[model samples]
Target: MVLPISRFWYKFSLFLACLLVFWAGFYPEWVEKYYAQAFYPHWSRTLRFLLGNIPFSLGDLVYGLALLLLFWAIGRMGRDWGRMGFRSASWLWLGKILHALLWVYLLFSLCWGLLYVRPSLGTRWQLKPVAYQKEDIRRLTLSLLDSTRKYRQRLGTEAVWRPCRDSLVPWTLSAYAPLALAQRTPALDQASLKPSLFGAVGDWVGYTGYFNPFTGEGQYRADLPFVLQPFVALHETAHQLGYAPEDEASWVAYTAALNHPSDRVRYSAHLELLGYALAEEFLLYGQEGSFAAFDSIAKENKARMDPGVRADRKRIRDFFLSRQNQVSPAMNALYDQYLKLNRQEKGLRSYHAVLSWALAHQN
Candidate 1:
């Protein structure tokens, strides 16, 4: 008796999946560093440039194509399996189980390896304080402007300035390339990270954002006030650029916004760091000056904040402080592990680390 072509194909796919799982688990670093470097960095930007400006609805296009393929596959399977009966059914069930097992094994291997090696990989940079005074803000702003101008000169017209839905595609694609190659998959479904109402309801300041590991999409809720939106947009955009670690994302976004040409964008970046500076001051010095600085900035920011924006921020802050948002011991441990893996010596809590860099340099 001859084996069916479908059975042979399914078995081959299963074998390939198993091989991928083994490779991914044992050699994640090689895969991440080498394979990722080859296509991800350059292809990402090219693909984004090509697809970013397409005007058609991606949802409609994707769903329509998926439905068509699903129906076509079902029809073909039904016709073919009608002749094989129990044998076809058995093969189908077996193939599905093998596929699922392969997926589970791959996921387990990747996560386990990442968790295991995180501590060994370290960061190259450190944060130490420099004097920061109100008088220095103008100088700092000018330095950022110079950096932005230089970067623009280097990149020419292709430089990223404004935030758009497609602006983040390159970053997201690059971040996920390793996983995609490891699993021998085309790409994960990034559409899941698209902004939704559900995400906006939870601890989100009218602008919930996420760096989705599965699809590698950095999604953001775009309805927030302009003051906060630019910074958050840059933060999420950084994640899309393969900066998975939160503090790094914060730093990159801060720099990006600070360098942006617009005054509002610059202010947004400053505010984010200023908030972190205040937090650090409170934790380290515990002086009236620390609180005084925070209060002054808060009052100034508040005077500028739109009423609707203030209400939204208050609602989001309350949600963040609620029981549901409380940090779990396990999560904290994992965070520590992640910091160690990423070479972040200061651990996982310093979104303000960029301030030290900002303070030390003058344009």
Candidate 2:
């Protein structure tokens, strides 16, 4: 007979996942306060410490075994189809998969999904200092351009260009020391960032990195250009630290990376934020001020950018553009829907909202 234990837990886990969904949906306001006060800080630190010092990913092994188990289960059901009876074998294995899925969802929700309901970092920081005008954006852009030039010269060779390929874990950890950690909470300091198991998959999908709520691991795509890795890793780690919304996380990541200990990493952060600032400047001041701001980039800064960094810029552009064909419309639609469901009304454009947040810090 099929084991009764498998069937019971499968159904029970699904029930709990559904219950948590509705409970969170209806009472996110309450969850925000309660989770922040009673659960989040302690829970995040506990998970962080559990595997933070391991140097390798515990989540990776768990995932590898899960994939192997999936294949084994599929084969077992096929092999037993006649002896166990088709109906019985099918239910036993299918129920096992469903049980695993339910438990995964339940774990994910408890660990990270509730963070989506938390108040934005904006509210925490109170960014109402928008009185500064377009001149501020231009000034910041020039400063970032100047900073970017200095770092490019500091990073003289391509030796550092191949960061993720050479194992970026140490540099990633080191980059965190200069952060203006907004909460001032002590537990966040215990958290550490690591590389992801699915780093290859990240390259294929244009994923920079993602915070694995399952194991509280911060992993970045292993194939990103060396310059982009530090800030992207920090951004994903912001999620692990309970900053849920993309824009809010971007703001924190930008703040942290712009002030990072490594000069090269600081320039990389500014470079990323430059694109955002340029976009906003164009919107606010139109082509005139925008081009004028570009003109303001120091001649030495412009001259310092040789062909290699230009190639890196081209490579970064092509990375996303080339991946567009692989990403089906259905996937895009699904992500757009997911963002919308999460109150991201601007959908994917919400990521760009960090520009406004960046400009806010200038004054």
Candidate 3:
């Protein structure tokens, strides 16, 4: 009687696992926000950091060993089950199905959390700027950099990146940082900056710094111009840090790169933001004057964009838009749902909305 009860429970577990796998694939947003914040956020930052990050790094080694044992067990089980006729074969089949369902659940959970929950939580706690002004931008940028410098003094030079990365979250808290500190802050208008041309046709650059959502590990094109690389790197790093919303990631990346001590890094942040401002102006205003301003900035950028950089951008563009790219409309829709679930009113399109906030506060 006890053995029969145990078998029933095992079968029920497998059934529930299959249901969750199906739900996760079809309606990931349903689980993204509430689950992460409710379960994962209560832990101390140190504990969360250890469990989410450190364990994964170590888990890779164990995973290798586990795979070896898994293969051995499967081989042995296949031979043994083959001789047991239908009764044992059915149990083995059930076990295999249960294992597949569990794998799917884990994959869906990670993707949903990374693309939805991380951004929502980070944005919810993001520091909002109290004021906006050119001088304020300059002051805040400098102040943030000073704070990072102090952090480095305590942690040593090797720990410099931590301060730099941490500074990004607070840098875009207000309009002041964008207006005062950025070296070439451009005026925003539809004519000067427009929505990405690719976006007009439902195509997107999708060049985020994070790994592929499904596989959770894959290299992306890294051929952007040096002037743009640092900011892009920081933006992608923001995604890796679990800030999935595009606007938040952009702002965070801008702040990180700007606060970095390296001149090149600062320049990269400024240039990337300037490009967005110009793009926004072209799309929204389309005024001749705004276009003129954009042309001037573009010429300046062109002079700076060396032959190698141009070639690299082209290569990267090709790679991002190629058939091998893994993005899909369903994925975009999933992102949209998650955005709404996280309280972003505009959904996935909110990425472009950051320009409004940037422009309204521009010095």
Candidate 4:
């Protein structure tokens, strides 16, 4: 009787949560003013305070335990089906599953997901949007290429790269100082970026970094190319700061990385942004139906880059190519759908929107 009463309340809670989620979609300003600005920072800071200093990921451990519990529950359900029969047991298990899902959604929303509905970082920053021509893209690409060349020249040899990787979290934390919105400082005591427990498997899944919303921890694959690590750390940290969209997070990371004290960090930003600018430039040519011109210009751009920068680019390309797997495409497609469901209209292609943001900020 007590168990049944408890289940009834859980179901009621789930219904209320569903209504709240729907309501949140329609009232982003209320969500932003109340949840993002007022509620999120406090609880997020508390979660980080409790879990951030731990050397290993408490969040990952919890996830592993949850997976095991799910398997055990599935086996239990199979046995219950055979013994008690479907009519007797199925609804009970269904209620249990729904109860679990309700909690997951509530936890996700409370921790970080509600930020998805907030005004975009561009709007928050009040960056004026401008109509950019192909010439603007070409010029931006060349300028980024120049910066990358200069920064790569500043960063010599693999030895310098190692210390830069080691210092990424601190450098990124300092970089966020100027970018903070009101009451939204990302630099927290003990809230250090961590290496992902999944490690090399992340290469197969095609993610360099992710934020554990449950723990308020930013995590990166430890085995990523040294040149790319700083930007990944910064990107994941942006998520920790409640910039939920990939493009917004990428843009935040780009801005922070460029302002980072170390040239290596700035080089990583310029290198990645250069890739985006080049992609935009290529798209512009394709829109004009001049694939031939794009090809010639791309070759020229590569040839003009510093030799060390070109080698680093090759290293990054070779790293991903070598790790390419069948699972990555399926995982990417699923993530694309997830992004679309969360209001990113372009899905995986939204990451490229950073170039447009950059262009707007430049103007």
Candidate 5:
């Protein structure tokens, strides 16, 4: 049912899509002006308006149905291979599979994937890129470390907040208020943000939050520590705002959370960015001597953290480590490939590029 095209038409459509993708690569400004700024806002707004009040994640439901359909197709093709012979079945199903993929890619691109080709967030904002050194990263790490401790101190020991959707939604929206006002972009006055239906599975699979581009909804794991939820939610919402790349979403979210009025939200943002800053700083230390020596240096660096910060970080680390399984690495590898295919040159490493943008902004 998905393929309403003849074989010739399917090939033609695929050819057109390839051409469009090639054109998009060369004309990022055009995509930014027409698609990201003009078309995507109206399209995403309509989707949010239609889907926002739903009590559950319609996006998750869509994914579930899609998986079922995939399984059904595989089963049907297997049956066809027995009945119609290998060559005949291959001829039949391969074309169908290609057609299905074409439809999926087209829908994905029209809905959200084309945002991948839009101008970089820095270019969009006209921020001058700074040539940062190891010292800049070290200073940023120290600054973030100090702020994280201060904010964590403010929250005291009672950091566990209930995932009250009512307040959480507004908290994230309000974080974007100043940016929305300044940019005069689409108003995220309403949201289709939800706790992901796949929360438990997501913990093992490793994602705190994601935006469902197909359904125009932002989803976060409700079971995440309160400290992690605010920034995760804001990051997902950044996707809904049409910042497609991981680093772009993170940079936008970090900047927004920094402007947030709540100490908890600001603390959450700084704490996570501190980790990124530290990781970048660690790379500066490089591989000095043996693994044992590097491990010693790592431990020494961590030993400098505030006691409460160390404990909290350990709790967060242990939470994920306990849930991790054999599947996590394979899933992560797949996602890394997915990012690379989407034009993120650093793949998973793109998430850490927020530190570079932050450093640029600082300079």
Candidate 6:
């Protein structure tokens, strides 16, 4: 009888959610005006200040409690099996689960999901779609690769810029600030980036970072190599700024990183772009083009990577291949479906869209 009342609200919420999602999808500019400009900026900043001082991720604790509650529910269900009767108790749990699912979707929508309908990074930057030739991509890849070598050498030689576990968060936010200003996105600085408590686990799932819609917190996998931190952090920060599409966020991060002043930060960003460009080239023009782009790096410059830097790069690369058991295929599948339902037709592959947008911006 109590569950019936809860189910009533769930039905109402689902109906309203359907209407809102349809309207948001139909007229995104209205979402920008009625939602983004009117509320999110102030709301996110207040969230940032309240949560920033704690110096650790509150979202992590929330998830931990959620898991505990789930297990508790399961145990209770087992105990109640005879008392409540099988069908009655099973019906109760299923209803509660559906109600919970609806509420999570609603919360996600109001908090950060509307951002999925926002204009793309290319639109914000006024980048015209150019018919990119292989020559264009090759040239851009070559230029970035050269710049990457220079900055890698410059940063590597300076022992002071060496990776410190404690300085990671501060350095990431600092690199993000100028890019925010450059892009005229004031909301970018509203929330500080958070380190994932479950970072070691994240590496196995191939997630470098993610945003918590419920908390408006940006979180990066802390277990990542130092060389890979800035790019991942800034990319997550892009989500905090209300870019919902994964690729668009990556583009924003790359844009900011490319303009970053610090040699270490700039090199990290350039290295990320170099990888993206090379991948696109390989897909579009095959291995010959990728090899050509790779060979463009000066031999002397390639040899200049410090032993520590080389190790950092290797650690980042190996995270995907080395850890299999910890990854959750079911969770990944659900997330993939979520992305497709939102705005990304390519689903998980949308993250790579950063490369083309970034290259176009460079030109």
lDDT of each: 0.49, 0.68, 0.45, 0.80, 0.83, 0.71
Per-candidate TM-scores read: 0.47, 0.72, 0.43, 0.91, 0.92, 0.83
C-alpha lDDT of residue 69 in model 1: 69
Residue-level lDDT tens digits of model 5 in 1-363: 364569668588686986786578678899889998889999998988999889789998899899999999999999999999999999999888877877788778889999999977777687755567767987787788788878877787576344545567888889988889889335787877898898887956688888998999998888887778888888888999899999888888898888788887898888889889878777866634457755765685676677777777888888888888888888899899999999998899989888888988887
| Model 1 lowest lDDT segment of ten | 113-122
What TM-score does structure 6 among the candidates reach?
0.83
Task: Supply candidate 3's per-residue lDDT for 142.
Answer: 37
Q: What lDDT score goes with residue 236 in model 2?
A: 76
Which ranking of candidates, highest TM-score first? 5, 4, 6, 2, 1, 3
Clashing pairs in 6: none
For candidate 4, lDDT tens digit of each residue in 217-318? Answer: 888878888888888888887887778998888888898877677887888888889878888888887788887887888898978788888888888889
The residue ranges of model 5 lying beyond 4 angstroms of the native Cα positions read 1-18, 160-165, 288-304
Q: Summarize candidate 3's per-residue lDDT along 184-211 as a digit string, tens digits.
A: 2211111101111122122342433333
Highest lDDT scorer:
5
User: Model 1 over residues 32-63: C-alpha lDDT tens digits?
Assistant: 56434444444444433444444432433444
Task: Report the candidate with higher lDDT, 2 versus 6.
Answer: 6
Show how many residue pairs clash in every candidate, following the order shown: 5, 0, 24, 0, 0, 0
lDDT ranking, best first? 5, 4, 6, 2, 1, 3
Model 1 / residue 82 / CA error / Å: 32
Between candidates 2 and 5, the lDDT winner = 5
lDDT of 6 at 347: 81
Comparing candidate 3 with candidate 6, which one achieves the higher lDDT?
6
